[model samples]
Target: MANGWAPDGAVQDQIDDTVKDAVLRARGMMPSGDGSDECDDCGEDIPAARRAALPGTRRCVACQAKRDATLRSVGINRRGSKDSQLR
Candidate 1:
């Protein structure tokens, strides 16, 4: 059945677009490998272990946590199908 403003498939398309936008935005947020030891947000020292684990890490653990918490995630298909969304 079609909704007033959106067709049946149109809602799915909007969802897909939203997912794609979220993925692109997340990719853009990936920390770059600038080799900076200081946290970009807090200016704290980036631990050696963290640096080793995340080669391209630019934020310290605390800063990274803050960023992660602040990060916004959109509804994306986990199973590549709408069945998952129905569950």
Candidate 2:
């Protein structure tokens, strides 16, 4: 299975790298430390129940949902090659 210009195992290497990047990104997105009393994004009070339940939340429900929506709209392109850029 010789790729025209890629060396052997290059495809698998790309896949592995993509998976590793995704894992690192997911870990970075994890909440950390004690939950803040106020929303970090909107300056609104975070509910006691939300803080208690999530333990490390920094945003109110509305702000958190908005942040999540923004994140969801931004897709990560692991394969940042020129071909991928063209597409």
**Candidate 1 lDDT, 4-85, residue by residue in tens:** 7655887677778887888898788776656678877888888898888777888887777887888666465533567775
- Report lDDT per candidate: 0.75, 0.82
> Which residue window of length 10 is worst by lDDT in model 1?
72-81
lDDT of 2 by residue, 1-87 (tens): 647887898878878887887888878887898779998888989999988888899989998788877886344575577987998
**Per-residue lDDT for 70 in model 2?**
80
The TM-scores, one per candidate, come to 0.58, 0.61
**Model 2 steric clash pairs:** none
On TM-score, the candidate that comes out on top is 2
